[model samples]
Target: MRTPTRFKAGAVILSAVALTVTACGTGGGDTSGGATADAGSGTGEIKVWGHQGEEGEVAALQAAVAGFNSSQKGVKATLQLIPSADYTKTVSATSPDQLPDVLEYDGPLMASFAYDKKLAPVEGLVSAQTIGNQTDSVKTQNTYQLDKKLYGVSMYDSGLGVYGNKALLDAAGVTYPKGLGDAWTADQFQTALEKLAAKDPDQKVLDVKENYGGEWPTYGFLPIVNSAGALAIKDNKAEGNLNSAPVVKAVQQFAGWRKFVDPNSDDKAFTDGRVALSWVGHWQYNPYNKALGQKLVVLPLPDFGAGTKSGQGSWAWGIGGSSKNGKAAGLFLDYLLNDSNVTAMTTANAAPPGTKTVIATDPLYKPGGPLQLFADGLSKTCGANPPTTACVATPRPVTPAYPVFSQQFSQAFLNIYKGGDAQAELDKAAKAIDQDFTDNNNYTS
Candidate 1:
């Protein structure tokens, strides 16, 4: 959750590797002692694994683990941090019995692990209140519950929006949106871009982060497809849905904005004042706020016919399916989701809190707060269904085939943004995704 750029490759590779690796069944063994004993037991140690994130992230996580370890007795918790680049490889290579009792994973990849039976259901194990308190978007991300069962949970969630320079917009006679409800229409947005470009020294009005090229295109631009009332997948397939008229039209409109975009190769277009608007995530808040101070303003992405939409979901926690200490692991999860801990993690990451209580109290996300638009957008997620006009926050497709879907869609975005044929590239992407889903038998056993 530090940023998509850090761990995208590992997650992409994890799913492909998972499909080839033999599915491992539930069992128990000790990671430290190598003993044939249940680590999930009340008295045994609970080993936790998480991605080594940014400096603040690492410090916050260590503090949380330390707090949990000292809070009580009986079950001791130890955390092991894996470098982001190697997190997936380590999980793929480890034997199930040797895997940590508590594992941290990206939200979208939960389906791949749940389908492989690598994670256990969290419903009865974690408290009813804990699960119930999570944001609707969090529930959608964590649950492999299309079968009606819970699996994973996260401390915080991710979102996307437009960051505008107030002075720049004002000087250009451009009106910025107050919130999601008043988000600019596609034409209005394009007009604003043109106006801002005229005022900008470099004539680059937007930074869509073309440099952070892994899972970002899918995370940041899928809203363009979703806002147009189109989806990348439906009924477990991508053929007709992805290559449909609305999707192509939406993508074409996005490509039309290419001339105003800053290549952002050096990643300083927005921060350095070369660009007036940056289409990015919450992780950029501190830097953007620091640079502009009173001039920085956050707004929802433009409405693309249907409504203003954004993407949601981030790193979450789960109990390993093979751990015998489900109760102990659940306790740790419950501890992590408590208001204080949730605030700690979300504050460190500058992400939206997973729980309602923290969001209500958080200065950055409370009503009329600078980042409230993100919370409002996340509260109206489309869940596992296709998005509609009313849906504003759409999670990535919840399917084991997501890795393939993301890869293909991202490549199509790059090609289309570079002036490739939108329809042709999307059709090629749709076919490749469908082939992967077919090869896996729609991921249905």
Candidate 2:
């Protein structure tokens, strides 16, 4: 079942070199492949591809295309919505000639496509001022450069934070960790967790949702590592970074959290009083608040000696180099990025809006709104803030090897959760990743 809200960004896990072949060829628009005309020749059907979601999401996309077809006379835009699970697979499986003109991709993989020359130059399609107007999250996650050209742009950003059972904190004589301003310190957070464990010996203190595999480990657990004063990945590699002293110490402490947390994978653990906090995405806002009522409060992750690291970057769109109609495809993509369209899509999914203009105007995203804390947290971690001894919004690693890296890191994290050595497992994962890098010539990044 596709969770309409699951930002299951493209699961581009295929590691074989063969995958790149399908994504690239001797093309115009930056890549070496069938030379593309200077612009959309017009009159040809412009195929747009995106992952399927809720009815409203589907409607929003269809409505965008309908508007495009109606507004233009020569180029007719058509949206082909693929199942969420098959999105990346379908893209990878398509031959160069069969690829979509415009593709909606998960924010993180933008660089991967650009690295392989699968996407076309984006700066030429849109203005620098237009790209500059995007949110920090979009700037960090969506845009990429290859050789010398900029390749992609994000349509929106998403939010991640913790849901607290306020009663659990109060009854344990602990003050709730507020939003970014009063986020708990590393030591304070652990003390609070300990207090909760002492109060209800059988209950868990934290739920980072490790059981829902795929990108959860990298997306969910990586913040703790970053918050500990080190990155989980750096410059498209993880050797020294993932196994750095700070990361190792952080993982060691997280292992201690196991004794305080219940193994249950359900979010209801908080509602049932089986847990005190659930580190989760903003999508949990309504249901979690509904369950916990006035006792619920959302908070940023504790600053683990360094700074809090909240995730940004969600889904985004870009034009493929294989498109015969780059101009028409870019038009459709830009239409989808318009304020009204962005508002509709994000509001339907209860996600944070991506652009500054949209975020400023959206009621739910305004300061003091129900999800403002989530939006604020994302700003600090992945936004324009610089990382040093303070909290910051960090972008995911830029390697084309992410799918394979995500898999190994997930296993390593699971091993640590199950009482394995953090350093050993991380090193093992890094070794495996480096080996794949050597095997594929680092995906020619």
Candidate 3:
């Protein structure tokens, strides 16, 4: 399973350091020793590596691998689990030939890997039907599809939005958005927060999971920037887009909402009724629903002038560029993505399913379901350069410099959240990102 979306406050500082160290040697666009030749022709032993997760997640993965191994005789697949934190570093340090036949990586990182030639296109290897069955959002997340060739596929994806307390909302006379089309405007959201705060013991009506940091800031708060009509990067440059007026203003506006936010140190602000609204992801659904029962309801994120944008992307699978067992690996990968296997994984992690068929049958994400808003949000993704409005989901930027790109933007946002000057922080991050891009020769190799 993925780590909790929120991290302890101090993890913010540590995340930057860990990410820097993890992505140190992963620059350039070299294809040397990469699997440029057709890989569908190879077969035999297939090695697969996945992030080590919780007991249930780990069990689900193990079961899938077992099923795949038993279903065939021409090839044998072996599974290995690595700590999520160290998975990237381990892969980066390994020679291409030493890498696993198939490896799981964070969805947004696929561009970086593909640029570095650490991944091979999964288009011809995996079954066409398996690839076609994926949701539109999943396809967008795995956008490293150079020359129209897909490089990765995921069994499940992630979602982000608001979870409201029906009683608290009604008592405050606040009307929350039911779906993407009716998301609350910035004014409406702020007013709702104020009203909800007035009825709270501590005057904190919202929980943005402040006690957490790390990727949490980027994953949870970047949408505010997007919704405010700004792209973190545009045309392979960050200077103008990321530090633009819209982005700075969005950060300032978001910072202004701190007064109504619960720190949620014990992660009980929402579950304990200390907060009327929770801005989180699908991972918290079970607990939030269990605690509030009939009072719990899922709502769309606030529309920040441009539109309501939410975050979507998660761990996905890709073939190693140097894999000799690419054909065999594809077989296991296809099996792992089958409907039953996808259901098993989604059931264990409580994430949105990657495939369209599975999503249609999911209890939480299906139409008229409690979390249907999340599914609906995914259907309206703002791709590489989406229009200012009419989009609900925004995939993280696709770039080989993303490791540095994400690190810089996330740290800048965290600084803004902690009271740093928004313009200054963003300007600094944008410059650093552009410099990295220059150092990597624009990653056009």
Candidate 4:
């Protein structure tokens, strides 16, 4: 899902190659201050940066920063909005003088920056104890990291799920699957799709051309692989487990369902009232609600088997390593991550709350709502933890070279859907991924 916020201020659009910076460098030396500058005596200015998009979101962040600045007598915080697409480029290029004291970073980019030493270890500022008191999924995605170092804190959690149009199910006289308890197996899911297809052979029930990049598939289809007990990448090695018996069976099942999906359809295939269900993220709540004008029933993505490790995804906040006012920035980070602030951000973003406390109490999470079901699924079935490296075994990676990786994965999947050999395409893609890690010195093994 697109972050509702983006960088405002002056934005400089760049060609695909060169890194770009937005705001002109404001002349000011680093104002050195103690890490524990008392709120009453802390006298310095701290600049905060984040993606600027939705007006309400930007205003909310600005208000939070303002509250922090006003709550203290000694320090002031300045807010700088950056466009989401250009944030990484701007953050990477800016010197200490121009970078913000604190930043809201995309989770996937955190590892790349941390690996490059562009971000500071936040362990000293926030403790596991503090995070533990928040949401389980939020803490799991944020605190768990590569090399056992805590580099980011998540403000919201997002995951993929099947959004069923209850009206469509009712019209077709099909019973909506129970929560995760009755989650369908791969065959069951395909059977349901085939039934839906047969019910209206003239129309599609799902869209097959949707992008499978990153967590969308992890949330939508990885559970199938996991249920099959298929190993994606074990011990940092490429495993063609995708071609293994269980996985192959799952893939074949998916291909069967493709018959009922219109290859040319877009998300509107469901959102525009053309299909029975759509694979989407929790963040799509607002747009979906706005379009449907009623609550959509969400079902736990069906499992391929009886596996316990369901894949999930998250977005996090990180601090820049080059910031001169590291302490002030850390303080601001702590404040923004407080339970209340995290809940506010997650709710505003229309995503699942990261903390357990909020998940238990957020009004949006009614007992039978889709959000609550997602939260339960997260608690019972999410994977061990996300990989700290740039690329993962399945879906894709979050490295600096993600553009190239995504392009390759997209092409390979398109080929597979068009009658190309799944093994051949995956093998070719795996070799490319291995080469990417080797060439970039990202391979750990």
Best by lDDT: 3
lDDT by residue (27-78, candidate 4, tens digit) is: 1211111112122222488777787646665666777777788777666778
Flag the better candidate by lDDT, 2 or 4. 2
Which has the higher lDDT value, candidate number 2 or candidate number 3?
3
Backbone clashes under 3 angstroms, per model: 2, 12, 2, 16
Stretch of 10 with least lDDT, candidate 1: 25-34
Q: Decide which is better by TM-score, 1 or 3.
A: 3
TM-score of 1: 0.92
For model 3, residues 314-344, the per-residue Cα lDDT tens digits are 8889899878767777888889999999999
lDDT of 1 by residue, 100-193 (tens): 7889877777776666556667876778999989988889887763464667787888878999988888989998899878999999999999
Q: Top model by TM-score, which number?
A: 3
Arrange candidates by TM-score, highest first: which order? 3, 1, 2, 4
TM-scores of the candidates in the order shown: 0.92, 0.88, 0.94, 0.78
The lDDT ranking, best first, is 3, 1, 2, 4
lDDT for position 427 in model 2: 94
Shift in Å, residue 3, candidate 3: 7.3
- Candidate 1 runs further than 4 Å off: 1-40
Overlapping backbone residue pairs in candidate 4 total 16
Quote the lDDT for 271 in model 1.
Answer: 80
